[model samples]
Structure formats: structure tokens, C-alpha cells
Target: MNNLNKELHLTNRPVDMPTLEDFRIVEKSISELKENEVLVKTLYLSVDPYMRGRMSDAKSYIEPFQLNEKISGGAVGEVIESNSDNFKQGDIVAGMLGWSEYNVVNGHALNKINPELAPVTTSLGILGMPGLTAYFGLLDIGQPKEGETVVISGAAGAVGSIVGQIAKIKGAYVVGIAGSDDKTDYLMNELNFDKAINYKTTPNMKEALQEACPNGVDVYFENVGGEISDAVFTMLNKFARICVCGAISTYNLPSNEDIGPRIQRTLIKSSVLMKGFVVNDYAERWSEGIKQIAQWLNEGKLTYEETITEGFENIPDAFLGLFKGSNLGKQLVKIAEPTYAKL
Candidate 1:
């Protein structure tokens, strides 16, 4: 086994949008396994927009990433060595592991993955956090009804895409708002959304939304917050529900520039229900969400897409790309190919 490993560390707190200089790759020797420890050879790792919040030292739902330490998120790997009875060589596992060529983690922190059931990458994507976020946020919060207008900002993203599909399954009239023409095409043609507006090209977002949703929006899945959300809010119907899944548009903005029209008046006038949430809020029922999403996937009722960056060294690029709308669905970094297990 190779004793030396490479790890990406946060070198500095980003001011606005992050740059490559904020991160540094450090090489170190892998320590010997202790009790209940497992040596994992990273296969694939996920890069998500939500991670942008943790880059700053401000208060958040999760802890901030300590400087000069390994950055961590969802990763899948093959176990090469294990000291615990729970795992053995060749077992594939998934967990919130460090961004590295390899990792030494406690067996309990990882969940065993069966590659035969679905692609292991899905564990970090549609079958994992993103999928669950879409499931619970849409069904539990948005609660789209039949023939209702459901509009989603960031509709081409990992969570938003799945939310749109699930809304369609519920017989809702789904309209998606994305950044590019290609993404708009993916939403309407590939995801079968009733309408898709390219916010970048659209001269009047509010007018486009008004035309697309003639009946007004009954459920609004808010992902990219800013002007896009402001447009969606204008066309919301009475008793509408707004599921606040993410605010990518505001993630990189400075405090002063993050201001927008206050939503209290709109919510009060329309009797709209707006609630923000993180996926762990539904932790008690994760299995239920995953099982239902998996069944929908298997039954051909749900589908997903991935924009995988090819190497571990490119993880930062993949993460930064999220703000630029460079990816269509889930963005991931392929760290290394599995040696102990077959895919």
C-alpha cells in the first residue's frame, strides 16, 4: 500500500467567489490503522453549492472547515484494509470523507454500498443528499397538487432537476427556470417540464413566468435566490408553498450586495408559506425518502444527470464551477479508480 497521500486543504477564507489560491494540496504519510479504522481508496467525491457556506467562518448549520485541514464531503471508496468486523477488503463504502486520493476513516462513519443495485456514484448524487433534498423539499414542503403550476429556480441543478421530475410525477404543470439555453432544453425536453425559461436570455423574467404559468404558481422550489426568485414570487397563487432548498445566487455575494425586496409583504398578501430547510431536518425519515426515490428510479419515473470532473486535482475547479452554472446536474470529481472492487 502507498503510504503517501494527497489532501486538499483550505488555505484561506474566500472573500467573495473562491479562487484556486484559497486551497492548497498537501502531501503527507498515511498513518497506520487504529481500532475500528478502515483504509479507503477514494473513487469519486461530490462537489456541491451548499459547501460554499462552509468556506466562510460565519455561523451556519454545519461547522466551518478548519484552515490547513483536509476538506470533506460525500465520497465513495473501496476498502483496502480494515480493523473492524463491519468491513473487509474490497467492500465499497460511502461517507462524508476528506477530499483526497485516499482516506482513513472509522468504519462506522461509512455505509456499505452495493454496486450491483446502482452506480456507486449515485450515492453522492440522486440516491444520496441531492435526491433526498429534492424528495422531502418537494413532497413535504412544496406539496404540488394535480394540474397545479410548479416553478423551480435552478431547475437544471442536482436538487432542482429531481424536484421538477417528482412534481411531474404528481401531475403538476412544471415550469423550470435555468441559466442557459441548453439547460432550459434539458428541463423541458429531457425532464419533460411543461416550460423552461432561460433567465440569462429572457429580457423579462416576470413576463416570461407570467406567460408560462398562466394559472399562477402553486408550488415554488427556490434554489437560486435573487432576481429569479423575485420574478417567481410575483406570479405565485394564494395558499402557494415555497420550498427554500438553496440560495446559490446569494452564496458568493457580500453582505451589502445581498439585499433584495423584503418578501414579508408578498407572503402576507398571497398567504404564501415559505420555509427554508437543510436535508438533515428530515434525517429521521431518510430511509423512507431514499427508498421511494430509488423505487422511482427503478420504475423509470425518475432520472438524473452528472457532470463529473476526471481527477482528484480538479476538485476545486468542479466546486467553483457550481457558481458559474458549468454543470447541468450533479458535479463530482473522480479521484481514483477502484483497485479492490469491480465496478
Candidate 2:
């Protein structure tokens, strides 16, 4: 922030995989914090698939990242300086910090975190946006019923993985579809999913879904919306609820005119209630989900996994990995660590 340190700042728009050249080092004088503001030293950064949508210059649930601007998302950092009565110099908080060494945050924009239960890093993973997406999206949209059959695509991802676990805990039979065997193993073994199917290896998805959910899908957690979801659509039971959380499979495609899944006819016959949601739609209830997730983590009812990249230089790598299904869990970046480290 001063002559002794510099920040890695984004300088260009990246098509897919961004390189160091896409960013530049910027130097600036450290300024004193204003009233109700806190200076935070960045510790962890979140790299998610949704950020990809944000990078593109398109109108959606949120605004796109401007070219040559320092991009920001969810980040965990320590309060190095504070002017607010509510926070102190050593408190840790999570909020929208940009891709840099430090950021000034209004006290209202930051949420203080407890470091003991699962590690402060988990605040960027299981206790972060991905976790809330899974919690509210499934409960509020999917409305999964006990003994009902629930199917989730992108089963190994941050949101999808937790969706399966919550469904199982609600007394529903959960089945997950992923891209690799190791992910399938994680879903079946570690997460305790009732069954896990490898979509890359399976030749017929319709048959796989039918075999996995002999009773038919009662709640569809739509994580990937390509041929996999098309097949699952045909297997939905009457009055099924579909939570359209994401469409990673269709994201690369230009638009719905080219890549959206086709199957509205099945929806009419099954009387399915399919709803698309952005997690922020329930922003008023964000804390409720976080509190519940924290309770679940404390109770050992939920386990979280993360694929963390160690530096800001690798932010792009961490991001692009989501599309290739290379990450087994939540993907994040550790931008800096002048002090914090795993014990």
C-alpha cells in the first residue's frame, strides 16, 4: 500500500483463463480510515462460477466487472485499522473486498467471524455465498419433502454438494450427477449421498436417473443444465419442484437462443414448478441461512471441502477450473497472509 508494498490490480478483460499480464501491480499511499470505516488486510478470496457471468458484459442479476478495474467479490480479511466503535484492529471480517492487498470497508458492509469452529478460511467456503445458495435455494425453491427423491446435477460443487447433503438430512433420497469418478466417490462416501452417477462415463442419463430414483425425482436441484437436465426432466414426478440454481453446462454457450435446455413440454405434463433464483433474492434472510449452516457445521451434520489457490496470481486459474469441473469442492484464493496461516 506504500513504498514497501504494492497491490495486484486487474487491468484487462479476460476471455476465459486470465494471465498475470491481464493484471498489473499498482502502488499507492496508505490513507487513514474514515469514520465508520475499517482497513482490512485481505486473507482469502472467493473464485466462483457466478463470477464468470459477472465478468462478461451482460445484464443479469448483477453488474459486470468493468475493464481495467480492480475486481471485487467475497473476501475474508483482518481489520488492520478501524474508526468504528463496533470493530477493532484484530477482528476478522468477510465482505466484498477487491483483488488487492487491502481495502477500506464500511462497518455495515463487513460481518465479523469467529475463527474456532471450522477455521476462518471456511468463512469463504462453507459459511459463504456458496453455502447460502445451497441452503435457501433448496429449502425455499426445491421444497424437498421427506422420503421424496431429489436429484442434483453438478453434484460435487460447493452449492450442489451441500444441496445433496441437506436433502438427505431432510429424510429424502438424494442422487448426485458429477463429471468424474473421484467426485462420484466423494459424493457417495464423504457426503453420504444415496447414489452418485458419473455423467461423463454414463452413456444414458435417462436410464441412470430412473435407476437411481426408482420413485422419480420429486425435487430437482438444477446445477448443470444440458443433456443431463434434459434427461432428468423426463423423470420428474407430478407436482415436482425444480430449483434452477445454475447452468454451468450451458454457461459457455452464447445464450438461451443457442444453449438453453429444451423441454418445456415435459413440464406441463408433470405439473412441475420450475423456478430460477439468484441467492440475493433472499438477501433479507441471508443471516438466517448462515446461522443454520454454522449450526450444522458445529453439529458435524455438514462437512465442507475447498480447492484453494494460494495467491492472487492464480485467481484466474481458480476461476476457470470451475467450468472444466476440475475442482471437487468450493474454489477460493488466498491472496495474502502477512500473519494468518494454518496451524
Whole-model lDDT values for every prediction: 0.94, 0.83
Candidate 1 accuracy as TM-score: 0.99
Per-candidate TM equals 0.99, 0.92
Sliding window of 10 residues with minimal summed lDDT for model 1 = 253-262
Q: In the order shown, what is each candidate's alpha-carbon RMSD?
A: 0.7, 2.4
Best by lDDT: 1
| Per-residue lDDT of model 2, residues 144-249, tens digit only | 8889999999999989999998998899999999999999999999999999999999998888888999999999999888888888988889999999999887
- What number of backbone clashes does candidate 2 have, counting pairs of residues 3 or more apart or in separate chains? 0
Off by over 4 Å in 2: 1-32, 338-343
Candidate 1 lDDT, tens digit per residue, 72-114?
9999999999998999999999999998888889989999999
